[model samples]
Each structure stands twice: as C-alpha cells, then as structure tokens.
Target: MKTTCKSLLLYVLIASVAVNAFDPFTATFVVGVGAALGRWIYEYSQEKCDSKWIAFNATGLETDLERRLFGQHIASRIILKAVTGFMKNDNPKKPLVLSLHGWTGTGKNFVSQMIAENIYKEGMESSFVHVFTSELHFPHPSQLETYKTQLQQWVKGNVTNCAQSMFIFDEMDKMHPGLIDSIKPYLDYYDKLDGVSYRKAIFIFLSNAGGESITQTALDFWSAGRDREEIELRDLEVALSLSVFNNKKSGLWHTSLIDKNLVDFFVPFLPLEHKHVVLCALAEMEAKGLQRNLDVADRVARDLVYFPKPERVFSVKGCKTIDSKLDYYT
Candidate 1:
C-alpha cells in the first residue's frame, strides 16, 4: 500500500509541474499549437515537443501499471515499450497496432483505459478516442457490406480530424468474419491514402481468442515449478498467433491482418491466480476510501470461483468480478 501511495503522490506532484497546475479537475491550459488549441481542452493539455512524454507521462504510466495491475509481467512490459516508442517517434512508418488476447478479467480493458487516460486528459471520454464493440455496433450479418463502408468512413473521418486519434475494437471474437478486413487499407504502410496519412493513428483489438492456449501454457509453467516472469514473449507468441488464426470462433480467423503480418504485436494476458485476486481486492478497498484490510481481501478472494478441477490454480473469470465480491465484504 505504501508503494501505491508513494506512486500517486509522486505522480500528482510531477503532473502539477508538467502542466503548471496541480488540480486535475479544473485546471486550464494555455496551448499555443493551432491544432491543440482547438481541442475541447480537457484538464490536461500542453505543447508536446520532442518526446517529453508528449501529453503523456511515461513515469506515471509505468508506476500505475506496476502499482495497480497485478500479474502478467509480459503484458506490462510489451504495452509500455510499444506505446513509448510509438509516441516518441514523430514520423512512424505505420500506425501502432496491438492485439490483446486472453481470458476475461485479465486487465485488457483496464490497460486500455490506462493508455487513454495517460494520453488524453479526458481519457475514454476524449473525442480523440473512439471505441467500438462488435456485439453492439454490428449485430446483423446481413448488413456486413454496409457496416464495412461505414466502419472505413468512421476511421478515416476520425483520423483526419486528429492525427493522434486512437481506435479500440472490443470483443473481436464476436465480430463478423469479413468485417475486420474492411479497414485493412488504412492499417497498411502508405504515405497518404486519398490525402490523409494514417501513420500517427493507433489501433488496439481486444478479444478472448487464443485464451485457452495461453492458460494451458501458464499451467504448464506452474506444474514445472518455474517462475511466471521467466515466461517470455517468444514462449507464447508463435502458438498464440497460430491458434487465433485457425480458431474458427475468432473474428480474426484466417483474416489478412494476421496472414500479412499487419499486427505489430500479439499481447497475451495470462489468467489470474489466488494471489493476484487478493491484490485486486486490496486495491479496490483503497479505491473505495476504506481502510486496507487483508482479512476482508482474503475473504473476498476465497469467495470467487476458480477452475482446473480440484487444483483450482486459475481464476475462471479472472478479476472481472472482483469489484462486486469486494463490495460484499466491505
């Protein structure tokens, strides 16, 4: 808990000086850039020059990931490096593309929110961030053609408005088979397509596909008595790619996105265990302004369901349902 407190305190202090104001709620910015000045200007906005974290805070983001996001060392490292490199580069050859794969409640969405909050002052609410859910946005199969046209237009329009626009696609497994390929042209390496350059945009896909393979690998590592941190990207990247490509249930099944190597990275989120869940519950306790109680956190963690028969090594739903379980105890 002291670590979290220290991180937050240090971040607040640095953020205050970075923007020349402390309060994240009501501070106004004096942006000089013509493009940035027109933005609705959330509580955080500043002239980004060279890689000074841009409008983003590298230290704060790393602290947040380490302090709150438990388990999955591979994920935290991959996300930080990828984002930092992309943001620092002024002339990226192609937009940053990442596909996060894992079981439910494995912190995919949480990390996504973290990225948004660090980049834009308003976070997910920022107009520059556009989120689309497969189940909600494209529900019908008959409208596949129309959805394709609209999706392309939506992406083009948003990126044209802001060079640093972010696009997040959720539940890709639920999306239609051919739907994802609609925007393939935009994700390619092109200086300008119809007059707009997409080299500065970001695309993130979140899905449950390839989760089974990831869990099995983690289980194997555990059975061997090896450290989870030792499991590197090379260990799972190949198997994950093949599994998602052939898995008929996935939205990217046989899609060109994987075939042509359009995806820059395929990040895997391992299933959570008992210790991780306890940490999550404790964090929840802190967030709720309640006293940190290990007893209550343990009780909440024990109450949640686990899987793999009698061994019960992995969380079935990850930490997705931890908030409600914590609420029961508090």
Candidate 2:
C-alpha cells in the first residue's frame, strides 16, 4: 500500500511539471510542428497515390504535330500512329522505338518537343520525358559501361514510378559504341518485372548519320526539276537504315536495335528548302504575335547561304539558323 501511494505521487509530480513546462510559446511551437508534419505526410501520400499517366488529346495533338512540325509528312504520320497505338494499347509487348535520321535543323528536336508537350502533362519538363545527348551526357568511349548502368537504372526507376515515359536520345551519331545497345532489354519483347512494364514507354533517336545521302537525294530531285515531295519514305527508309547500319561512325552501327529489327520505325527528316525556311520565318513571326510578313521572311531566306555552288539551289543550313536570322529582319 505504501509503495503504490509513492508511485501515484511520482506520476502526479511528473504530470504537473509537464503542464508547467509547456508554456504558450512551447504549445504554439509544438502545434506548428505537428501541423507541418501532418501537411508533409499528406502531400507525400498524394504524390504516391497520384497517377502519372497523362491523357493525350488525340485530335488536338495530331493537328498540332502536323501543323507545327513543318516539312516532314512521313515522320509526322509515323509519330501519330505510334503515340495513338501505345496510348490505346491495353497490352504491349515492347516499347515503341523510332530512329529519326536527318541533317541538322530538320526539326528533329522540335518534333521531340512537340511529342513531350502533347503526351506529357508537364510537357518536356516532365520527369517522365528524359533526353540524353551523346556529346553532352556521354562523350568519352571509356564511359560506356557507366552510361549503360546509369541508363538501365534510370529506365527502371522511371518505369517503376510510371509506365508511360518518353526518352529522347540526341546526337546519336556521336554516341559511344555499345551505349545505344544498353537499352535493348527495356525495348525488347518482355513481360513485366517487379510490377514495372516498359512497353508503354517511347524511345526516339535523333541522328545526323545519313545527312549526306539525304542532302544528295534532295539536291538530285531539285536538279531534275522534280518536286521535293516526290522524295517519299520508300525512297529514303531503306537507304537511310543501310547507311546508319553500315557507317562505323554511326551510333546505330553494330547496335542490335537496327540489326534485330527492334526499331519500330525509321523516320527520315528531309532537308528543308527555301520555301520551308520562309515558312519557318513566318511561323516565328506569328509566334512573336507579329503579323505575317512575307517580305521579312523572304529577306531572312535570302540572307541564308544555299548549296550546289552556282545554282544556289537550297538553304544550306535549312531552318536551323532562321530563328536567329529573323532578329536582323525584325
């Protein structure tokens, strides 16, 4: 009885001290910390439960991809089909892979930006849309192993978080050997692993490997007085694929993505002519909220150098330098 009374007295004393020590300031601090912690927990739960899959506006995207993306009808069509198919597919065995071969300034990067904008909720800034540049990301040949490990981890981590992801690889022709092959596992036909499925993802490769042949083909058509549109997918697909495969300098060379036919599409970006540059300039002007000025566009187009020496057939840099050249005209 005496020991029990002493224990009760000790409990009462501790309770009194706690109450006294908790002043108004202490109470407010405690409440503030608790509220902050609660908010943090709630936000974390929301993020975890949130669905990263963004709903694509098919009709709107198709129109924008076609309209905003100038001069590449074949590429636009293939991109549309791939995006639509992947989004609608309930079961996919492998990821949609595309090899975009063209010279610089043919809108390869622009098309990629368009895809991200339409497909991803956050657009190019989305965590799901990852862009890897050979020159920027992995330039050294010795870094191939490191790059492979990093690439695999990145793919696995993102797919685990969200199945719908887009990966754009730029300067593929400058990439180190075996680096491009690192993604074969994620791209190949496979079942889900650890609840992660990469089949819903998209992979785009941009390269200038076959720029010479593409330019030659375009020039040949111009010389023959044939319409540029006369050069179709059939005329370039096989040749471009072969050129990328055969060239040792190409990133796709010796990579099974091309040899094993894992690449879903080989979309060639044709060289932009004077007319396309003018269109680009006009588009730029419009984007700046300025009225359509054909005179300014013509002047911009004239300022750019053209090829075939004497004939001065086409815009040498395509629409690559049009944006900067427009500043002077404006």
Candidate 3:
C-alpha cells in the first residue's frame, strides 16, 4: 500500500509538471518538431517501399475512354494489349509501336501517357517500359549541325538497340522533312537488327494534315463572294478527305512519315470524327472538374471547320459546337 501511494504521487507530480509547461512558444515548438519527425518518417518509409502508384488500370479506364469514344474503345484496347505484350516479353526483339500526332497535338505527352497508363494497368512499371518522344523544332542555323549530332547521340543511346520501344513524334506536320530524313537511319537500324524470330514492334503515325489544310484551302476559295453554307459543307468534306501528310515529291498524301518504308502502321486523323471524340472526352473531364486548356481544342476544331475563317469562327460564341448540346458557335 505504501509503494502504490508513492507511485500515484509520482504520476501526479509528472502530470502537474506537464500541465504547468504551457508556454505558447514551447507548445508550438513541440508541435513543429512532431510534424517534422512525422514527415521524415513518412518520407523514409516511402523511399524504402517498393510499391508505386499505378497510373492505369484496364478495368478503370474501360469506363473512362468508353464514355468519350464509343466504338474507339476497341482500338484503345488493342493498343493497350499490344503495349502490354511488349512489356511481358523480356526479349527486346519485339516490334515497337510508334504513334505520331499531327500539328498542335502533343502526341508525345498524350499518346505516351495513354500507352503508359495502359501498360501500368497490366501490372507494368514505367521503368520497364520504353516510350520515346521526338519533337522536331526548326533549330537556328548555327545550332542545326550541333543539334543533329546531339540527336544522333540520343538515338544511339536511348533508342538504337531497345527491342521493344515506342517512338512517338508529336506534331508530325511541324516536323521538317529533313528532320525525318535524319531519323531514317535509326529506324533502319531497328529494322535490320530485328530478326524474324523477334516479335515485330509496330509503328503508328497519326496526322491531321489532310483535314486542316484542305479545309483551309476550301475556306479561302469560298470566302470570295460564294454561298457560305455550301462552301462550308464542301470544305468539311474536303478536309475530311485531306491526307495528314502529303509527299511533295510523289504527290502521294500520307498522314505520317513516308521516307522510311520500315514504318508498319499509319493512322490518319479524320478531322470531324477525331475532333468530335476528343472534344466529348474533354467535356466529360471538364464536367468532372478536371482542368484542361480547351483553347487548343477550340482552335483545332475551328481550323478544321472554317479553315480560312478560323479567327472569325472562334470569335463567334455559338459558331463552334463542343457537344450536341454545348455550342461554342456564336
């Protein structure tokens, strides 16, 4: 009984000391120290942990893009499957898929993310997948040769021998023909080095050249004292039929790079159809409070519809329609 009373007295004294030590500065310091310690522990644990944030899940994404593009989900699934297959086989001998985007579209970021997410959904990590993006910019005359040399080095280092890598070129139209020529050797290297036993890596080049340019030309022609509606419809049809990239030398129109015969897959952008799908997707994201700069989409859509009068069309509030219900058209 005496020992128990002594223990109670000791606890009461400690509690009294703690309660008396109530200086604001001391409390703040204690809290700050605790917060710092907690942060340090969390960071340490994260560094030591092997788990990663999964960016894509097939089951989850099925509902995502499906609400955006109805039947195109089939194509998206195929793309996801193809990339996953490439990841599963450790053999670098698999064919790589190159997805190219048209002018104003950042194919590298968008397509690469989509592909990356799809691969991740299949339980693959970003480090295990190789997605390369080549952006062709018109370099200054003085820096052209140096840039070329650096580009060659980069290709050799990152892209040369990888058996399964996707090379995506954003804004194919902006890519100078000379720049495309420069990369021809790398594509050839991949092709020649790939044996028949190696899984074929696929290349996909997507472009919107045909639709945008044709629509612009038609709008220019129709702007001169002609029936606007008829001209608009005609321009739309022409834009729809316009090829993404036209071979200036051969008169053959293609949406993707043509100098390299090794490119196995070419995807042309159907302006009206592709634009509609993308816009709908953007609208859905916007509705969900996902931030996106719709200005780019607006500009691209206007360029497709009233090529010559893009500025005028954009200025009109109701002229450009996003969805069947959301009209940006003035």
Report model 2's TM-score to 2 decimal places: 0.83
lDDT of 2 by residue, 207-300 (tens): 9888888778877878888988788877776678678998887788898887678898888888877778889999999988989899999899
Q: Cα RMSD (Å) between model 2 and the true structure?
A: 10.9
Indicate the residue-level lDDT of 53 in model 3. 30
* Residue 232 displacement (Å), model 1: 1.5
Question: lDDT per model, in order?
Answer: 0.84, 0.79, 0.42
- Kindly give the stretch of ten consecutive residues in candidate 2 with the minimal lDDT sum: 44-53
Model 3 Cα lDDT, one tens digit per residue, 76-138: 454555555545555644355443322332122344555545534332244334333334344
Better of 1 and 2 by lDDT: 1
Candidate 1 Cα lDDT to native: 0.84
Which ranges in model 1 have alpha carbons more than 4 Å from their true place?
1-54
For candidate 2, what is the lDDT? Answer: 0.79
| Best by the lDDT measure | 1
